[model samples]
Target chain A: MKALKALSTSVGSKYLVALTGLSLVGFLTAHLAGNLLILLGPEKFNGYGHALISNPLVIPAELGLIGLLLLHIFKALRHVLLGRTARPQAYTRKVWAGAPSRKSWGSTTMLVSGIILLVFLVSHIATLKFGADYPSAEPGVRDLYRLVVEVFHSPGIVAFYVVAMVVIGLHLRHGISSAFQSLGLMTPGWTASILAIGLWLSVILAGGFALIPVWVYLFL
Target chain B: MKVHLKVWRQTGPDATGRLVDYTAENIAPDMSFLEMLDSVNETLIARGEDPIAFDSDCREGICGTCGVMVDGRPHGPDSCTTVCQLHMRRYNDGDTIVIEPWQALAFPLIKDLVVDRGAFDTIIQAGGYTSVNTGGAPDANAILIPKTVADEAMDAAVCIGCGACVAACKNASAALFTSAKITQLSLLPQGQAEASTRVVEMVDAMDAAGFGGCSNEGECEAVCPKGISLKHIATMNREYRKAMFANR
Candidate 1:
């Protein structure tokens, strides 16, 4: 109860949001690495996928990831609601307090991008993880590579995936540095580097993920 | 010089307000923003109309008594300057300047361009002081404070309690203001005794005042008249986290 009370404050809620958000970013990094294994051909990709799902710890990790995502959403939604009430009246002619202020399209539209990503996440899991399960030639290991290839074969899905990745990039553009600030890890000496990393990391991760579907749609 | 003014006019807190336009004429470029408003108010009074209401004191910018959303930016377009100190030269003739009160739930609009910053006072009263008592002023050498620590403390202490940070924030968060207070006290030897209780109580008071959470956008830091760095906010967060665990 004490911890919960401590975490419910404006400062504490932000701390939790930052912690969960950065954890999700960590999960994304691992996920992207795993997804990129598709480039190694079916044997390598399927073997990797099979190895991952077959591990006993996989289910617990997946559940933990789900818990983290839910908590992130809960805290983020609470923030948006609180923001609305904080300034009951809107400014008639608000302007961005330009540079040195990190206000951006990404920062402003984080809620929108996040909501979009949530919808994309559900559709993504349904199509790939819970979609058609074709048997592998080696047996036991579901042909996840085939499922991925088949999914990417659709132009509509490939286009959608690319668009979703862009939204993810938009979320991360502000999220990375923001998380550090929320966690109190940001300092004058490290602020500039953190900002740069937030921008480049978002681009690298989103662009890297986006390339996969495009590469599959074209070459595979 | 002349400029077009679209100033917010509200009779009371519950009254619906709107921007009423008036032309400010015969304005000198050297005049401060508040002085220009004085010229406009003079004209309105001469015309037997209610003059635009705003707040100002110590027009030199130290009192932190004057501020308004001038053309959508708090304290006008200048950086590290308050509204009372913002010069009219920043504007061109015929420029349409829109002024509005600080719009935050914690800062209720009391008139045309003045909001009650009582929430800040409430936060301060919660824990912005040290309980240490001394009967007389001690010699400067009595406290062997490091120059860097003293400088850092002074930097945080420069915050004039202006609510511009809240006005500039998208979330209308009081983090910058509260953080400045927390950091200034936490860094000093006198502040060490109550450090844990101070951060916890002040932060709780800030949240209870209906201020939103910080998004770390740095808009507050950018708009701050005293150039209060966002580092103080980081320092505050560290203090808060430490207080939570230590006090527990």
Candidate 2:
């Protein structure tokens, strides 16, 4: 516990945030790629989804993913709260020096948007991954791809998912660069490369995930 | 070039302040911004008006003394340079320039375009130094700091205590300034003996002096005449964390 406290207090906490963020980035990419299987039509996509959830390794991975997400949110909230408490006066003047870096806006507002993302994630999983506790015509006949298409076909749900994907894109943009820096992988030349990679990864994940909803609403 | 200057005027520390407008005619484009101010002062002195009081010592960019909010930007429109080094060429003719002293609770207005930044000195005094004895200067090569470490320390050491970082910060945070000094000393082996003590005392002093906390904004680096990095702030946080646990 003392070690945990020490870890929490040190720059280690930043590492924790960075590592968890990277994990989420990886998860997003994998999730998006799997969802992209929907392009092959419902049978292949639903089979992939069934296989993923039924896999022996997935249960523990799911637990770990949950832990990682919670940890990231917890630490981010703590840091934001600590920073806020440390400075009571809101900025009223334009700073000419010592401005916050022009990194991704998502990274800066991660705490606020992370909460929104968390809510969206819960509702999304409850709707598709874990069926809502309501009686349906087909009870627990978990066809995730169909469920995804169905939910996205609704205008409100499509709008919500689109907004959530934007937030996710933002989160990944900052998180990618920040994660590399926190892990001590940032070199002068490598910094730009790493940031570029992070940007590409974010775009693909966000774009891919977002395309699913848009496709379902328009074409599918 | 002729320019109109709206300068903040406070007679003394206790007096209320107002902006006074003045015009300088036929100013040289190559003249440093301070030189233009000097020309205005010379004309004012000839007229027997108490020449608009301002602080400046080394006309050179170093020494960190010549600071003013020039036209809403610290050290004028130029990026990564001090006011004394800012030349008149950056502005066009007939420009209406607004100048003000550094405004912060910790930095009190002493007079027109001059704020008493003695709070910085006090904050430094609270801890900005290593407990080294005054003797013959140690051989530079004896330290053997890795080139990377030396480079990083030098980067942090470039902070001139100009309070530009504070002025540029929307929150008026001194974290960059404080962290730069803390990192400068804490990096070298010579300063290692007092590292833990130095970080704790300095951070406490900075907080006690009523400066805002850093929000990781990189504005300080942008306007810093020396281009000091905010990585030093991260270093300072690391040092402070170490001190808290190790000292305990």
Candidate 3:
């Protein structure tokens, strides 16, 4: 137990967080790319979704993705809680010096956003992936593509999705650069490139995810 | 130039303290902040009052002996310079400056503008050195360290053990100071043999001394006299993790 606690505080745990986080980001990008196919209308989009879910390799991959997400969030929360416990006086002081340097506002708020994202993910999977209220059977299936479109048609749902995506964007913006630095990849020349890539990835993920709801509500 | 000063005054370590106001005039812009305080002390001595007590020695900024909170900043308004290196030009002629000792549980007030930074020395003594022998120093080229590794180690070694990093931290964390020492030694071959013991002892000492854990606020780097990077903290974290597993 002491070793476990020490592991959470150690630098190796930082790498674990970074690697798991990177995998999650990669999943988000691929998921968003697939979702964007909905813009082509039901036939192309639903068929694409059907094709993906039906693929022989996809079931295990999805399960693996879920495992990665859980592990990433678990480790992140552990680090956050340990960090908080280590310094309980932070919130009371309006000003403090000698706090750890190299921390950013985005990095500090990651756990909050991650929790919010978890809530968003549960609602998302429940409604669309589980086909809870959709008019269809299990094997042959209801058209998940149409269900997604209908969900996005509601302004409230659309707004919630947009807000969630914004949180995700903020999380990625900090998490990406920090992950690389934690893995000992921070060279001066490479730092700018990594940061730029991280920023671009964040913008694309957030913008892409938010676009789905906006497109369905406005045009579809 | 003239400035209004609100300096903390205490008769001794056990005495109560208060902010005392003084007007300093005709201060040269080129004089470092401590030299200005020296001028003020000269006046106080002439008037037969006890002069303000502060810590300083090696006024060139390398000794890490001088530090004060000026206008709520650890080492004045500079980004990465010590109090002894900060020039008066950074302030307006009539500016009111507040100066006080490093405020932390571990750094008790020794007097006005000087706290007992002995806690840091204690932490250092706990594990900040290598056990390598001093018998006939090894050849300079014998080590053959990579340029990158040498440069990084040198960067960590530049830290002067000043508590400016702690004074600047919101949590008063000793992460920067402790990490700098850890990284400096960990990067060399001579220090490798005792690395695991060094990390565990140093970290335990840091905690036992009541220094707060790092919150990653980055203020320490901003006020570090040597511009020590936060990368060293990350490095220390890595070392501590390795030590834990290796020891177990």
Candidate 4:
């Protein structure tokens, strides 16, 4: 019975969302760390990228990361679908009040922001991983370092990336703490602090990602 | 005080509704929000027009019957008070108030501000109870409860099941309303027997009724006439999570 409950489609979707989302947040932290290596110039950045690709567990780990991302998107889209079906007919003169009225502009646009991030991720992997045209520092290795410098040199691409990272920042502001609340990881005493942490973490992560692009574009 | 009003009017369950304009004049400042509505209805009645239908029972705010979105706020502008308890003096002399029903898919409009809240009752019926044998009651002290736990449970117990939480929620989720019942019983010793079953059945019923999932906006607690805390929602999540691991 417990297993069935665990397996039920609707039984624990919210917690599923929270758990998967938190892992995705973890992935973002790791990815950000890897991205910041670009600030050290091509040799270091490409070295890190090459090492990541050459690791023995890379294939399995990559597959696991993909699974996590899929689950996160799946649970999030499920909530969106549920919310839509729950109110088939739109309200005529609807207005927000109390806490509902207190939503940030980013909180209100989570779906759109999330979709933007999804598009950015696919294009990002394609360009940085498979789309690199330059050769490696050592023979027969991919020169991801050259690609990084060249790509950030473009004004349009930098602009796109800057905007996307900020949206990610905004999304995380509400999302991280909200995931905690969903998972019941809150006490009255900790509520404000949890939310505060989410906000600060968002600013840091977004700021970190945004810094890399601008740095590569100008200083590099 | 005289006020301009745009009230929603729907003839029946199947009828499409729109906001109809009316001017209320010579309204006394001491009158309640519902009384102001009565004055407007009176004018329409004098012209042989169908009176605007609204719900009000126990106009003291205890019945959870009188509810409307006054100027886009549920139960009017006064905090922690229902429409019946809201006074006319809160509005300016020539203010235009946009009155609409508590709109949600679960609570469909019957007419005007009166929605069919039968969905709430259905959810309650699904579990919201213990299966203690029906007979002479046991001594109250037989199941001793701590003061703080009892008080917090009572706090959750105050929900009027008014559906204001649903209407106030952006997603139209009934998590607050449903959680109130779950938290109320799940805290009591007598309710421990069926705790697992109750949470599952009630949540299932809530989902089946087409209410949206809770995103913890906290609007329900803010707009609640009873000032029900979001702590109950946390308790509910705890209960639901436990049920997932411990029971079917």
Candidate 5:
């Protein structure tokens, strides 16, 4: 109870958000790695998917990810409320303090991008995880590779994934470095590198995931 | 030079405020921003109208007393300078400046361009000071603080508590101000005694004061009159984490 109370304070809650956010980043990296196996053909992809699904630890890991996602959303929503109440009156004409200031379109639009990603997350799980489960030639191993190719074959679904990946990119563009600052890991010497990491990580993950679908639609 | 102005006008705390237009003519380029306002107020007083109200004590930048949203940027566009130190030379002759008070629920409006910054005092009261008793003044070099450490502490110490950080923050958060106070004390030997309690209590006080959470966007550091770095914020976070674990 004491820990809960401490972590719930405005500053403390930020620690929670940063930790959970970065943990989710870790999850994305692994997910993206697994996703890239699609380029190696159906046999390799299906076997990898089967191994992951067969692992008893996968269920608990999925549960943990869900918990982290929900907590991140909860604390973020609370911040939105606090932000509203902090300034009952609004500025008449607010302008961005340019240069040396880190404020950006990505920083300001965090909440919007976050919400869009949340909606995409739901539809993504529905389409990929719970869609048709065809059995592979190897008994008991689901043909997950076929499902991915079929889904991406549709131009509409491919376009949706591309748009969703762009939103993810924008979200992480601000989120990665913001997480370090919140966790107190940032320093003047490392600030530039950390900022670069945020930008490049977002691009890599977004572009990498977006590539798989476009590749499958065009070549596979 | 002459300039047009749209300044926020409010009679009292509860009164609805609006941007009332005024013009200052024949102003010298070297006149400070406040001096231009002073000239405008002179015309209003001569016309038997209520002159605009603002706060200023020690027209020098060190006092942290004078500040206003000049053209939406805190303390005007100059970096590491206060509103009082900002000069009219930075503006074009016919430029229009819109001025507003530091708007935050924690800092209530007292007049047109002044808000009560007593919440900052409350945060200081919480734990911004060192409680250790030093027997009179010690020798100048007794503490033996490293030069780099002293310089960093002084950097954090330069925060004028002008509330520009809060005004510039999208969430109106006091994290930068609170962190600066925490960082200055935590870096010194005398400050070690209450370090843990200081961080925990001050952060709690900051939250109780109804300030918002930090978004780590660096706007606060940018608009700070003293250019207090956001590194102090990171230091504060580290201190808070250590304190929470240590106390538990």
Candidate 6:
């Protein structure tokens, strides 16, 4: 872990950023795949929820996820603050000054997107993760399926979720490939393809999350 | 050809600066960007005004000295060429050009278009060296370096330390500059002995100098006078990680 201790430096912190970001991407993928169970109706969704909480690994896995999220946030905040301190005097008139295809906008706005995501994450946890519980739809379980359906039913909450997803998407646009480059995973021949995939993944991942709320609100 | 210039002028590091307009008349198309500035400076001097103070050495572009933001692009609108080598032909006649010093908190303005890049020297002093003692030179072929490695090392070595990369970076990050030195030395067998300590020390120095971390934005590579690639930064990232992780 001495090596990891050294990673506490700015560049090393970047690797931590990439690692945590990738881990969160994994978390998102699994979360979405599991969320898909809601489409099978409340019984299956609630059953899935009960099964998840019943597993011995569930509590530890949740704790690990929280750790990853906290680490990601801490690193991001440190870098953002360092970035601001680096250029105390701002440019008077500015242009992005990079290739249009490989936009720097995403890179520059990461701090903003991160703040938005942090707010959204807090609201998400407060509203759904620890909000009021209904009587069991399944024996010896909270009616989490009713909660999901009820949560998405509100147009305002659905709208908030969609907007937050877009923010998350924007963060991922730069975060994905940047992480790879920071970790030295990029090669000249593969950079373009990797970036292209990163872009598509950003859109798909965010779009997938946004669709769930809308899908449940409308048809389910 | 003629051009209108809006140049940033400041009396000193703490003095207020502003973009003031000037005109260059009858400039030759073939003249380098710095040459046109020379004409403008000459006119200013003739009028008993202080000429713009900018840094330049080895007008051929290798010294890594002369640099300014012309129309928001570092070293003027030219790619892979320093301001001293950037031809006036890249601009149309009657074009308006805006020039500013490398604006970073870490680089305080000396006067006019020159800023003190002492932070770079500080970062260099932190580790940008191999500690071989003076002795008889080793045989040229004594240490075998693969052709690919020699080429790659040369690629990183091509960095002129112009500060253009930092100036052009949105966050004013010095990642490109720091990594260039890291990649250049860390690739060699002579440098390997101290790679671990060097990377950690250099990066700490860089951050302490108040330079931002690399976002891998590629802006620095695009405007680099020496065509230094982002790959060097990537390599540094890898090397830095290995140095840190392996230390444990």
- Candidate achieving the largest lDDT: 1
| Chain A TM-score for each of the predictions | 0.98, 0.87, 0.87, 0.91, 0.97, 0.93
Candidate 6 lDDT at B167 equals 93
Instruction: Name the lDDT value of residue A211 in candidate 3.
Output: 91
RMSD of each: 1.1, 5.0, 4.8, 1.9, 1.3, 2.2
Candidate 6 C-alpha lDDT tens digits along B1-248: 99999999999988889989999998999998888999999999999999988888899989988888878888876678888998888889999888889988788889999989999999999999999888998899999999998888899888888899899876688988999899989888988988888888888888888888777888888889888888778878888778866644
Better of 1 and 3 by lDDT: 1
Which of the two candidates, 1 or 3, achieves a greater TM-score against the reference? Answer: 1
Residue pairs in clash, model 5: none
RMSD of 3: 4.8
Calculate model 3's interface RMSD in Å: 5.4
Better structure of 4 and 5 per DockQ: 5
lDDT of 3: 0.78
Model 6, A57-90: lDDT tens digits are 9889989988998998899888877777777776
Q: Largest DockQ belongs to which candidate?
A: 1
Q: In candidate 6 chain A, what residue range of length 10 has the lowest lDDT sum? A: A95-104
CA lDDT of every candidate: 0.92, 0.76, 0.78, 0.82, 0.91, 0.85
Per-residue lDDT of candidate 2, residues A1-220 (tens digit): 1446434642446667878988888888788788889889877876786678668999899999999988988876765665554334232224333243543466567766777888989988887877533332344435666666677779998988989998888877777876766544654557569878988888888888888888889988
Candidates, DockQ:
0.78, 0.15, 0.17, 0.50, 0.73, 0.57
Tens-digit per-residue lDDT, B1-248, candidate 1:
99999999999999999999999999999999999999999999999999888999899989899999988999989999999998989988889899999999999999999899999999999999988677887787987989999999899989998899999998999999999988898888989888888988998999899999998889999999999989888988898888878934
True-structure lDDT of candidate 4:
0.82
TM-score of chain A of 1: 0.98
Clashing pairs in 1: none
* Candidate 4 clash pair list: A99-B219
Full candidate order by lDDT, most accurate first: 1, 5, 6, 4, 3, 2
Alpha-carbon deviation at A63 in model 1, angstroms = 1.3
What residue runs in model 3 are displaced by over 4 Å at the alpha carbon?
A1-5, A10-16, A43-105, A111-132, A136-139, A187-189, B5-26, B38-53, B98-119, B134-152, B169-173, B200-218, B237-248
